[model samples]
Target: MEKKLTKDDLKEIENQLSCPSGSKGIEVAVSMNVKNISMTKASIDLLKIANNDVILEIGHGNCGHLEYLLNQAANIHYIGLEISKTMNQEAILNSNSLGTSMNTSFELYDGEKLPFENNSIDKIFTVNTIYFWKNPNVFLQEISRVLKKNGVCILTFAQKKFMQTLPFVNTKFKLYSTEDIILLVNNTPFSITDTIHKKENIKSKAGDDVDREYTITILKQ
Candidate 1:
């Protein structure tokens, strides 16, 4: 047996930390991805968004984050992109279950190739999914093509800044840094808007109390 932080690591992590037993109910597996922030605090940042904004949520697992975002930006139009139909369908169901959504919807599409017109979206957000993007440059370019001028993208990860938090620990994980992501985004049409590093504790799928640090990066077109 080997220990590594690859796609298998994440998939196993997602499976372990999922709340509730079985695939029944809303199946909030992805919630563990952002458990460090406590879903409640994540909602606060989403509250700052303006009303009637056009939003695009990428790699939406079950729409828990989207539901929180919708609370503040009521008039916003939201579309979710997910590669897995099962996860995408679950996200749609979750969004609809949260009291008859009016402007929120879900789509089963690959995040690398989004179907959107140029300068159409006002804001974009992703949690715990950015690092998994196969072609980050193309993904960013597609995002740039769809973002309106002044539109912003906020990417928050539960463990992106793990390298900083565990400086003395050596782990077999491909820990991505804020600078790495910034460079990736900079290569696209968008530029960095803001970068903030913060500490947040999370409960892992294994029920381990893990303190994860994330660097929140805002990219603007």
Candidate 2:
């Protein structure tokens, strides 16, 4: 039988999920890459990438899907921004291992402001990272500012109800529903172009079989 998690264990999981670090953080990131692959692919599809497009992904833990994303189009450049140093290094290492180092780059940030100029990026996306945004409203503006006119930003996250069931999602995590996110977007500069709710049968991080409910919110400036 699997060992039960203690209070400290759950808290550690929550912290690593937010901004991974150390050896435990590395392990957690690898697990996250597996768990979030489907969500990542779905978000990538919504981006509608084209030839020579500049793509940005926030909180790209280890970026194990970089090859799949690069194969979407010709001559694409991918930039991964992360708050976790471990994740930043791991992504670069993984990209190198995949022989995709030339076309990809990874950087660490404060998770508050994006380190790019206005109207710089062609497409932006983030999966399961919305819950950690220090200020969604202001950060949405940053996303808008960095994106060129008519740029697409796909935000994917599990619904509040589903996320609440996770043992590791503690007070540090801010869960949201479809309605809550829609309302939040309404207050931003970008307009919601599409909202997709999806469910999948998968094994949870805690090693339990369950149904996962998530949403993909597409935004345009």
The best candidate by lDDT is 2
User: Residue 114 deviation, candidate 2, in Å?
Assistant: 0.8
State candidate 1's TM-score.
0.77
RMSD of 1: 5.4
Candidate 2 Cα outliers beyond 4 Å, as residue runs: none
Tens-place lDDT per residue, model 1, 1-221, is 33445566555444433222346323445554356335334623842578888878776666666656676755878888877666767777777788646778777775577888988888887766665677778888888888888888887764545634432223323347777787787688888767777776665444455676766777776
User: TM-scores across all candidates?
Assistant: 0.77, 0.98
Q: lDDT at 23 for candidate 2?
A: 99
Q: RMSDs, each prediction?
A: 5.4, 0.8
Candidate 2, position 50, lDDT: 99
- Candidate 2: deviation at residue 21, Å? 0.7
